[model samples]
Target chain A: GAGVSQSPSNKVTEKGKDVELRCDPISGHTALYWYRQSLGQGLEFLIYFQGNSAPDKSGLPSDRFSAERTGGSVSTLTIQRTQQEDSAVYLCASSAPGSNQPQHFGDGTRLSIL
Target chain B: ELKVEQNPLFLSMQEGKNYTIYCNYSTTSDRLYWYRQDPGKSLESLFVLLSNGAVKQEGRLMASLDTKARLSTLHITAAVHDLSATYFCAATQRAGGTSYGKLTFGQGTILTVHP
Candidate 1:
């Protein structure tokens, strides 16, 4: 893809249900990131992946949230047993090999927990 | 933990006016970035400040960074209605091996350039 791509641009689920958001990063890019943006708030870091390095998960809000990248091309963010507070926009971005490069962002998936 | 704070969380300005948005971080960092977002849209990268006294300008917007003070400023000159959007500043810090390239973002400043 010419740019970062995210799937299921919008998702709505009942509380306690699980949801999955997917991201397809730019080809050949080695760095990927996930962030959450609540209404009227700033972007909150969730996770980061740099090549084969174990993903940095220190920013994950809870154990219920986890992400995995397959083949270093596509990634998935799964929220288990969603809560109302989990409602937010999940954004994905990819950079060229390192953190020094500017990131290209996806349109993001807006998750709504009812 | 690197914490970032942005001032003037909400700004309503008349078009053609000049103003500045301020960002301050709690820790020392070498990289700073500015991004813009419209309502119901994704973020767009605007500028990257890599060193103290680094400055970058694009059209009506200019961004500057001061690593020593842990501060960054986004200055709007002769603002236009099309520039109405939320602006954010983020800082990158490498901590051990798990927090590399982790960007800490400050609360965004919602700017409305009114005619």
Candidate 2:
């Protein structure tokens, strides 16, 4: 695809189950970011990946949230023991060269915990 | 920590009307960004302001930055129904000349346009 891509556009999991969300950035784009948006709400930062370096995991809400980027391309965000509050849309975006550039986003994955 | 705030959480306007959205941040940043998100969709990049005096305009939207005030604004000119969406302002933290572009976003301004 010509733009950022995310997988499992919708997910419904048991309250205690775990879930993984995937992202594929645009080819050659070096920056990736993850964010969460509750229904009718704004986005909350999650994490960011620059090039192949260690990702900045600062925005992660808790220890149960983790993410990994391989070969500077694709990333996976994992959430453990999901709670009802984890219900939200997880968004992925990628930018070229620098972070100051415009970011192209993928259709977010809507996760619902029951 | 950087704190960002936006006002007029919701705005309803008719086509051809104009409005402005404000974004304020707590700390100094290297750049500011504006994005748009439609219903149940991901964000769409709208603008990037690199410096205090930076201003960028496209179509019906114009975005400006003021590092001194730690503020940014997105202005709409002759708005249309297609312009309805949630608008977000983001700031990037930087140390030295290099920045990782980890953006902290403000609560979005929701615009409703009726034609």
Candidate 3:
């Protein structure tokens, strides 16, 4: 309730199966971000949303990855036909409207593709 | 495209020792952020450096920014076992109203402090 919250802390799916990860940002936070981190790798930006509208999706790896936000509060990241390479920790963060504000992060969802 | 690089991908230090982690970016950015992540845990925001010469300190960690050099540093003072974690630095550049606040992150520095 006080910090960013992500659902399905751990998810295991088949290589071809699709999965949806959910993020509930801090109440009143207007900026939400999605990032993916592979094993022993740095975080890779996936997308960012401002008040239910994604301003930049360039960081998305491919067409199979998509995200959407509704009511300016909750967001979902969908991965279609997942591959083994897609296994990683998906992190969600939220911040205030200001550009200089520090982001508060969720515990992150660890996805495993089998 | 913005590229971020961090030096000393791994560090092992004795307790009470000090160290600094470096972050360099290829393009101009409006802000820099530092974060800490423990094993199997999500990141925790450590600092936000907004302008050149900006510096912020929390506990034993201090972060500084140099816009002209496109560099940022996280200095750890008197390291403790509790400070053992992975540290990351991210840079953000505003392209326009739509592409604002997108961050490009550096490969994290994994620090291990021994007692």
Candidate 4:
């Protein structure tokens, strides 16, 4: 794909089940970011991955959330023991590892925990 | 903590009307960005400001950054219904802050331009 792509555009799951959302960043982008947006709300920073830098998890809401970026190209956000409030749109954006680079975004996966 | 605040959280305007959204950050930063997101869609990059007194415009929208004051503004000129959406202003935190090389976003302004 020419742009960032996120899989499972929409997902529904039980409250106790674990779910995974995938993000494929734009080619050659060395930085990846994950954010969560509740319905009709602003974005909340979740995690970030920068080239050769330690992934920042300061923004993750709780211990139920985790993410990993492999080979600096793809990322996955995993939610463990999801609760009803865990439902939200998970957004992924990628940017060049330089300053002032415009971040490119994916459509995001709308996850619903029942 | 670095905080970003956006004023006029919601704006409703008649077609051809004008409005401006203000973004104020709690710390000093040199880079700012504006993004637009439609309902159920991803973010679209609108403008990137690199320094103080930087100004950029596209079609009906214009953005300016004032690094000294740690503020940015998104001005909507003669807004149309098509421009109605959520606009987000984000700033990169300084190296000394808790969020280094990380973007802190405002609460977002929901603009609804009625035609």
**DockQ scores of all models, one per candidate:** 0.60, 0.69, 0.66, 0.55
Say which docking band candidate 4 falls in. Answer: medium
Each candidate's interface RMSD: 2.8, 1.8, 2.2, 3.2
Best by DockQ: 2
> Model 4, stretches more than 4 Å misplaced?
B94-100
Chain A TM-score per candidate? 0.93, 0.93, 0.96, 0.93
* Per-residue lDDT of candidate 4, residues B31-95 (tens digit): 89999999889999999998899999999999999888889999999999999999999887643
Candidate 3: where are CA atoms >4 Å away?
Answer: B95-99
Shares of reference contacts reproduced by the candidates, in order, are 0.64, 0.77, 0.74, 0.59
lDDT of 2: 0.86
User: Compared with the real two-chain complex, what DockQ does model 3 have?
Assistant: 0.66
- Using lDDT, rank the candidates from best to worst: 3, 1, 4, 2
**What stretches of model 2 exceed 4 Å from their correct place?**
B95-97
lDDT per model vs. reference:
0.89, 0.86, 0.91, 0.87
Question: Candidate 1 vs candidate 3: which has greater TM-score?
Answer: 3
Q: Which ten residues in a row have the lowest lDDT in candidate 3 chain B?
A: B94-103
Candidate 1 falls in which docking quality class?
medium
Over 4 Å off in model 1, which ranges?
Answer: B95-100
The CAPRI classification for model 2 reads as medium
Model 4: per-residue Cα lDDT at residue A106: 94
